[model samples]
Target: MPAPRILGAAAVLVLSAVILSACAGTPEEAAPEVTGNAQTPTAAAPEPTATPEPEPASTEKPTCETIISESVVADFESLGWSAQESPLYIGSTEITDGLQCMWADFEGPAGDHGQMYGWAPVTEAEATDAQDELIAQGWQREEDAAGVYITESAETVIAPDAEGYGITYLFGEGDVKVADTKQNLLLIEWPKS
Candidate 1:
């Protein structure tokens, strides 16, 4: 039995020696030799190209004059205003060298409220003719420092309308103020001073 024990110990010692011998080697063989130049890092897929920014859209509002002119004409025509008569004619004139007159009128409750507008380049005779026509139609001259004449009258028998015609005369330069009425609608006189 003692002899068998000795043999077992010897076998264990031999196996351990062989394992240690196999593991013992030069540093180059033990760890893989690193080349002088390190491996090039894979270029990060060329950083995905940045998408270009979109251009800004144009932002601009239409001119005020254009809007005003179009709106006035459209409103006047839509209201069934006749332009053939003395007080209802639609006309444009040069008030001054660079100014212009844009005027229009419609049949009023009394008769016709004649209006004259624009840069006022026309002679005083023309202005008087315009005023006279309105005066003949029972439109009273309005006292305004801004050179605007207004005439207002009420007629309940003509139509079941509540409001009557309000004629306004605009001249000089700038936007014209139009009077709104149920029967006559709107009359505008734009004068380019």
Candidate 2:
């Protein structure tokens, strides 16, 4: 029985040596061997891109005073009309990077004596998109020597049978005349440099 136990111990040692030799093998020896000359890349090369052109510089800076010509402001003052500057754009979509100016005859109610003008620092593409969206929203697109006009109208007083209230946007270069629908005869012009 002792002789049989000694033979079994020797057999276990031989099996352990074979297992150790396999465990200590190199990465290449452990991995399955490839049979072809084909090779796989870890990463692909990037495609070439064109150099982007720089945008042209803006020619003017706007402010409440500069937005409206001094002479026009003076004329309005003579008529008891005063202009107010707002950091917030009226009605909606305020231009934080630009100026918003509103002129009104504060002596009386708002009525048709209110006009707003604004200029935002938007790219040409953005302006085009805005114009397109405005047109899609039922605003008519009209072209003229002065530039462009996109307009829509609604009723304000809610008369029994009324026509239009007047909502218009007149723009050129990159400025907007956000007047109160040009409701009054005095139409304001917004300039952008």
* Candidate 2 segments whose C-alpha is farther than 4 A from its true place: 1-60, 87-92, 107-112, 154-165, 181-193
lDDT of 1 by residue, 1-193 (tens): 8999999999999999999988986434233345677644333334577899997764432222322356665665666543331222312322233222233444555443333222223345655665576567666565546665544444322322354444444433333332333232232223311
Candidate 1, run of 10 with poorest lDDT: 85-94
- Per-residue lDDT of 36-85 in model 2, one digit per residue for the tens? 87554434345689989998886666665666667877877788777777
Residue-pair clashes per candidate: 8, 0
Per-candidate local distance difference test? 0.43, 0.60
Local error of candidate 1 at residue 68 (angstroms): 1.9
TM-score against native, each model: 0.29, 0.47
User: What's the residue-level lDDT of 54 in candidate 2?
Assistant: 97
Clash total of candidate 1: 8
Candidate 2: residue pairs that collide: none
Residue 101 of model 2 has an lDDT of: 71
